[model samples]
Target: MITIQNLDKAFAKQKVLSDVTIKIADGEKVLLLGHNGAGKTTLIRCLLGEYRPDHGTVTVAGHSLAHERVAALRKIAFVPQLPPPIRFTLNELFEYAAKIGHCDIDKIRKNSIYFGLNTDAHDHKAFYKLSGGMKQKTLISIAFSRDADIFIFDEPTANLDTMGRDRFRERISADAMKEKTIIFIGHRLEELSSVVTRIIELDLGKVIRDEQA
Candidate 1:
């Protein structure tokens, strides 16, 4: 479902990823574990086409990110480390997502409720004004509501509380993500053990370990 070949990236004179390569098959849920500056985010950016690789190629479902960025990205559902600073109201945000993603707003509302976010209560609230947990829930809800073939989440639990995390796990458990390629970047792997079938660890911008769980 995803492949990276001879990927290299740098900022100024400092390298962030060095000849990194990986291939993740469909339905595999991978935990991208690494400390800060370990190049995890850099690699993700390259895969997402947010940062063109200094060298190499990233392909998703046979679509080259560099050459077919838009089409390739259409197959992915992403929840970033930080929620975007959009001031769109909850309804507007959902509307926009539905328009662009061609996803079901009903699914978004259902998933949000399952994740403990009452969309009805927050429908008039602007995204930026929601509490951290609420924001995280909404983002996760939106991501999951999409029909993308791949799902990527970065530090998704950073703003979630204990209960919210539990709700999140319940929503993204392996069975729930069947046939979808899921890649999650976060330090709390143990908390997500049930959903992860593979582990890919990065260190100092290089892939140090790739193993099946």
Candidate 2:
């Protein structure tokens, strides 16, 4: 389970997150909805132990993010909206992930195929040189191919095509969500309704609505 209690964050003079409190149980697929600057990214960063909450505690599977950051982060697999400017080749990227966590490079390759990404054709290509869709595909494949208890996706479908989106939906079906906790940050409510068990809306810096899907 994941717990956020009295969460508050600020950047310089801007208060980005308020005293937000929310609990997400295991196997729950939550869709975090918000416009730009609504504090969605801030909240996600807190959950991943990437941001220090000014006045709150965040616990993932009973591990406090403040005190046990590495432990808490080890259980999480995250994909950001914008892929980082990494210059590693596809093979090198997979090699790096293998050292970080239980990364299934084989599964990543299979997933690439599922998304029609044809990884074999660009195995030696620099990651940053790939097209937007290809980069998203690689990131998604790598994230999902890891051994993680929590999965976080920030606008994962941004650069996907019709076939890629459909394949993505298929990969995240119920069978794939059996035991993992998913926090999907998305702007639109499209085909994700079937995978998301809850919807959380944020306005400004506070949670405005939270409901069962």
Candidate 3:
């Protein structure tokens, strides 16, 4: 389970999130909905332990993020909207991920193939040198390779082709993911409705709507 209690965060006097409290149980597939600047990214950053809440606590799987950062983070697998600019080659990146987490290289390769990206064809290429679509696919594949308790996707299909997008939705709905807690940040509700069990909308740094799908 993941819990955010009375979360408050600000940047340079501008509040990005305020009194935001949410609890996500295991096996919940949630669609986090919001327009740009609605604090969705801020909340996600907090959950990832990239930002500390100024007035609240974040707990993942009974571990407090403030007190046990690494332990809390180890339970999550994340794919951000924009891929990071990493200079490492695919093979090197995979090696590093495996060192830090329970990363399955073969599963990563299979996932890359599922996304129409051939890992072998680009194993020696630097991540920063790949096309936008390729980078997104690689990030997704790596995230999926980890056996994590929670999966967070932020606009994960932005750079994917139409067929790739369809495949992604299918993968999210696959039985293998049925027991994991998945949070997807997306604007296309129609495309995600079939997979998401709940919808949580944010507006002006607050949750305006939250309901079952």
Candidate 4:
């Protein structure tokens, strides 16, 4: 389980998150919804150990983020808001991520097909040449390849067409059904309703609502 107690954060002179507290049980699919700059991304960064909370505690699977950053990070995977703007091919990107993430290459190769990444695209095409949706798909593939217990996704369907979005959600839903905890941060509410079990809304710097979908 993941738990946050009295979490607080600030940037420059502005407070971004204040006394935020939440508990996410195992296998839960939680959606973080809000307008731009509602502190959703900041919270995710703190959870990922990329940023430090000014005060409070964050624990994931019984490990404290403040105390066990490396250990905590090993159990979580983050798909950033923007896919990396790199010059490497899709395959090369995955290969590098897998090596750094310490993921299983064979499993990643198998899952790459589900992302609609063909062997041809994987072999020689540079990431910049792929469509935006394809680049997002490749990024997601690499994130899931890590086999982390918690998966954090930021605006996962930003650039996908109708069919691509549906296909991507299908794959993610399948994974969630297998009891993976997914924390999705996005502004697209309609797209998330079908997949999210709970919705947590943030306004300014506070969690204003928490409801079951």
Ranked by TM-score, the better of candidates 3 and 4 is 3
In model 1, the runs with Cα more than 4 Å from the true position are none
How accurate locally is residue 153 in candidate 3, as Cα lDDT from 0 to 100? 95
Clash count per candidate: 0, 0, 0, 0
Pairs that clash in candidate 2: none
Residue pairs in candidate 4 whose N, alpha carbon or C atoms collide under 3 angstroms: none
TM-scores for all candidates: the values are 0.95, 0.96, 0.96, 0.89
TM-score of 4: 0.89
lDDT of 4 by residue, 52-147 (tens): 999999988888998988887887888888776799876787788889899987767776677676756456888878887878877777777886
Candidates arranged by TM-score, highest first: 3, 2, 1, 4
In model 3, pairs of residues that clash are none
Clashes in predicted model 2: 0
Off by over 4 Å in 2: none
Local accuracy of candidate 2 as per-residue lDDT tens digits, 1-213: 999999999999889999999999999999999999899989999988889989999999899999998888888989998899999998899878766767767887887788888888999999999999999998888887888889999998989999988988887884866778889999987879888899999988899999999
Say what the RMSD of model 2 is.
1.2
Per-residue lDDT tens digits for candidate 3, residues 1-213, read 999999999999999999999999999999999999899989999988899889999999989988998889987999988888999998898788777767777787788898888778899999999999889888888888898879999999988998779888888888999999999998888998888999999998899999999
Question: Hey, what RMSD does candidate 4 come out at?
Answer: 2.1
lDDT at residue 126 of model 3 (Cα atoms): 96
